[model samples]
Target: MNDLEEVAGLLAKPEPSEEVVARSRSRLQHRALGHGARGHRTLGHRMRSPGRVRWFVPGVALVAAGAAAAVVIATGAVTNAGAPAPVSGKEVLLMAAVSAERTPQSSGTYWHVTATWLDSEIPPMESWTSRDGKRWTRNEPGDTSDTVVPASISLRLKGADVSFDDLEKLPTDPEALKAWIVQRKGNPDDMSTSEIQGDPTLTLLTLITELPTPADVRSAAFRALAATPGVENTGAVEGGQALRMPDPDGLGEEIKMVVDPETARVVRANLLLTADGSSGSSDGDIAVTTDWTDELPATPKDRP
Candidate 1:
């Protein structure tokens, strides 16, 4: 089996309200919820799934039976590996420490950030942070956190602090994944690759397929963590050397993420509904190639 076929196994693995639910479930039809044909021009905003009732994501591959198990992860790169595996009592202390360090007495962790994508028409470069999932702060920080600057958008996950495998374990819609599933032109069902290069390690997944759409990319990534095995933040699946699982419904797409294991932070990701059966690459005007290679910006002011 291919590497992803391998990762698919152990690696585990939303949407919105009703008016939102209608928006969330529209992935299959690839239509718009409240917008028109012109409004739906970009798949990023319109493609949302309705399964999780909290978010939407990308494509998936039902894993083949007993494909392969046992995956060896690189060191100090898979989440808290630098320290001894926590039991229960100590775990609490570690978590509390992590939280206190990032959270100020009455303020948040605000990091100056600059984001971009292949779509040059991106919003703008500005400051954005969220203290609790509900409120958003823009450019200038103040006492309150219920504002937006349009020019900037912060990266925050609303539901739970889910991991990669979480995507597969969660029940999310399938439509959104399609938009991010890229397999070259005319080779829809073909496979791709995801290469991760981080400090002290370099991990690569072959036949890399599946990703989350822009609309709900954040939640979709957590779903992926749900299913990851042999790793922390592995939502539903257990940890191990390697794992291979079946998609059943391509639910694997939900858990799409490329994170900095040590920092427990995200570096990059692609969520789109796809697998070994679809074809054609979404490129040109409708398609995009967003390349993200940036140092982890300072911790966001409002971190979880």
Candidate 2:
């Protein structure tokens, strides 16, 4: 089982009530993600392990974030009053939340994803899952044939195993969304990637990246991340803004994501070390593409 699948197994317990989750949120807000926060592995770290390699279900292009950032900057029209107001990282996230709320919803037969590693030999991958999240298929690197994914499998979101429908049904209000994720995430001790388990920032980022998530729910996730303490707007990169979250563990590793403020889409996500000045390469960096489509690829049985 992949890390997500392994984590999904631990969620058999009943979901916590709203009241219970609310209390949990209060504690989560106060506690930073690092500082002994368990299971805090990078996305690439988990994806590269011997047997666990899968494109992040709802991933995005690595350079897209940079290009999107450039767009955000190029269109910075000065206000009638003065220079465009300085925006905080929190403000940027909040703005993304608003944009997400305004996004129109879409549906189709399959939730499709394609991804490639930034600077590695990992082959590009394509995946398709039924809208309901029951059936799945994948095109492996260099393989002419399609592989059927087990119907029993599902992606992880906010610490729970969820179908596309479940994603659509997630709470739209920020506080409620936070409560819901924390409740499902349960204890960090049982999770494989400790980086996200107790960390509200990473949890919400994961929600934003997942496919088939309702627009408003994605907005809620952004708002929750913006509300978290210690998030910073580290200035403009290319055309987009860089929003950096706190590093509680003092591991010297920093996590930053680029967002296309215009569309409320996260263009890039990176896990970097403070001393690693070189941006030209990182094994864990990847480009992810996600969408919905009705045309499914023919399986081997349908092929000649």
Candidate 3:
């Protein structure tokens, strides 16, 4: 059978054992509670060796699997649906900017983000991060254990260590925000790189996924992206429209973001290889879900 058939076959298999399901759910719940200010003591119990398994919220995992299957089927039918009218990259970004600006301001004690990282060789890895940048929980599908880390950390933004307060304090004006990013980089030329992996445009793109960033700041970042040169609309991928920009590092890998126009949020981001036979060319993709809530999980079942 071909690759698509193989994927379909795998997804058609029966559900996991109830014991496995229960354990995974319990672990996730425990991790959620560990994000609380008083839950640090429970951190040691969750840490375990990383195993090759697909770890994600069970419900979300099923849905994502279904979605992946649909993508495989839809890819075969995309060409039959006559070509869609081209949309400008700037227009898309501007639309996203407007939507972002309209989002209500919210603050929370813990900023929660659930993300799935995909690669060819490894099973999709799911991770959750807490607000204080102190707790991170990760699991892989089929793995019975969750790896939890509790340490003071900062969200890496535009190559800088940005705390939650820093995110909130970012300038909301597009020009001012761009200037700030430039200043952070030390030199304007530093924003562009021929060998390094990051640049100003890439930094802004990354910022959009960071949930703790204020809505207006995100809006400004989108506006700055709209004004950036080299960004081009890449039509649609898996139902969402995509924008592509050449990697400034000259690595022949394009940064592609599948954007949800109505929400003005990126649904997925990918680093796709453009050059033939590039060694060590492992591509990566991320699917993100953000929750803005002040509630923390209750005390875990096994507290240290």
Candidate 4:
């Protein structure tokens, strides 16, 4: 099996510790009660709501699996011995950029993505966007609900409203892209000293995976992320070696991403907390699966 498939297999069979199970069960119960009383929002609403940041919470059955994946990664099981000696973060990103640049551009009436949010309280979220940027359809399988709306009401990346055209126009040069990202009102230049700083790398990573950006732009994003200071290669984790960066939100957290070396695509991401005298705790761990497809269902499945 391919490396990604192998990682997935390992992640699928977790042996959670008793403490982990207890924590997961408590979190699940808390979420159930909160959602039951407040009423859950539709996927469409959740997507557009700036305040709602969907976090992946492991379920009872998946607790061990997630822990296993993290442990294997922390222990370097994901690294391949046959691979060349480890390179600098910038070099690795440059390699990824080359791979992304060679990828074929996608064109279709709609951009469709099906993502399963493992360990999350919410169900899987599926979205379709019209090429002309006029229509959107979102489906939440857990609730058996679907919502159709204007593309103008779509999700934002790092609080920045962007469209397909904007993404296509992004600079491919790593330096240029870094300048562009830093100049954003939301991204502060003094990340090292500022009490608060936006994680531009997180924003770029989100766009690379969640948007139907052109291959060159995607590559540029990777290169830009590589050039970011404090970003480092954290050996193997899950689908591939992890590239880690400090959380820009100043929540005393760090962001770790598992990226496929062959394709330079992100396989998974984890938000781990940093606290003194505390074992590393994760605020959220997301496993994302994306597809840039040309076709989508003619109608929403659960349009009630």
Taking all chains together, each candidate's TM-score versus the true structure is: 0.25, 0.62, 0.59, 0.60
Between prediction 1 and prediction 3, the one with superior lDDT is: 3
For residues 160-224, could you state the per-residue lDDT of candidate 4 as single tens digits? 44567877787776556656665655312212222124345655666566677688878778767
Q: Could you say which candidate leads in lDDT?
A: 2
Native-structure RMSD, model 2: 14.2
CA shift of 157, model 4, Å:
3.5
For model 3, what is the error of residue 150's alpha carbon versus the real structure, in angstroms, after optimal superposition?
1.0
Task: State the local distance difference test value for candidate 2.
Answer: 0.49
Q: Is candidate 2 or candidate 4 better by lDDT?
A: 2
Ranking by TM-score: 2, 4, 3, 1
For residues 11-94, write the lDDT of model 3, one tens digit per residue: 233353444333433443343233221211121121111111112231221111100000221111112353222445655565
Q: Name the regions of candidate 3 deviating beyond 4 angstroms.
A: 1-84, 118-133, 139-145, 185-198, 271-284, 294-304
lDDT of 4: 0.47
Q: What does candidate 1 score on TM?
A: 0.25
Q: Which pairs, if any, clash in model 3?
A: 53-140, 53-141, 54-140, 54-141, 55-140, 55-141, 111-131
Off by over 4 Å in 2: 1-86, 135-152, 185-197, 247-250, 271-284
Per-residue CA lDDT of model 2 for 105-224, tens digit only, reads 777887776655555644555667775555454534224434543333345543345676677788887778777766774323213243344455555666676456788888878777
Which sequence of candidate numbers ranks them by lDDT, best first?
2, 3, 4, 1
CA displacement after TM-score superposition, residue 263 of candidate 1 (Å): 1.8
Q: Cα lDDT of all candidates, in order?
A: 0.23, 0.49, 0.48, 0.47
Better of 2 and 3 by TM-score: 2
Give the lowest summed-lDDT range of ten residues in model 3: 61-70
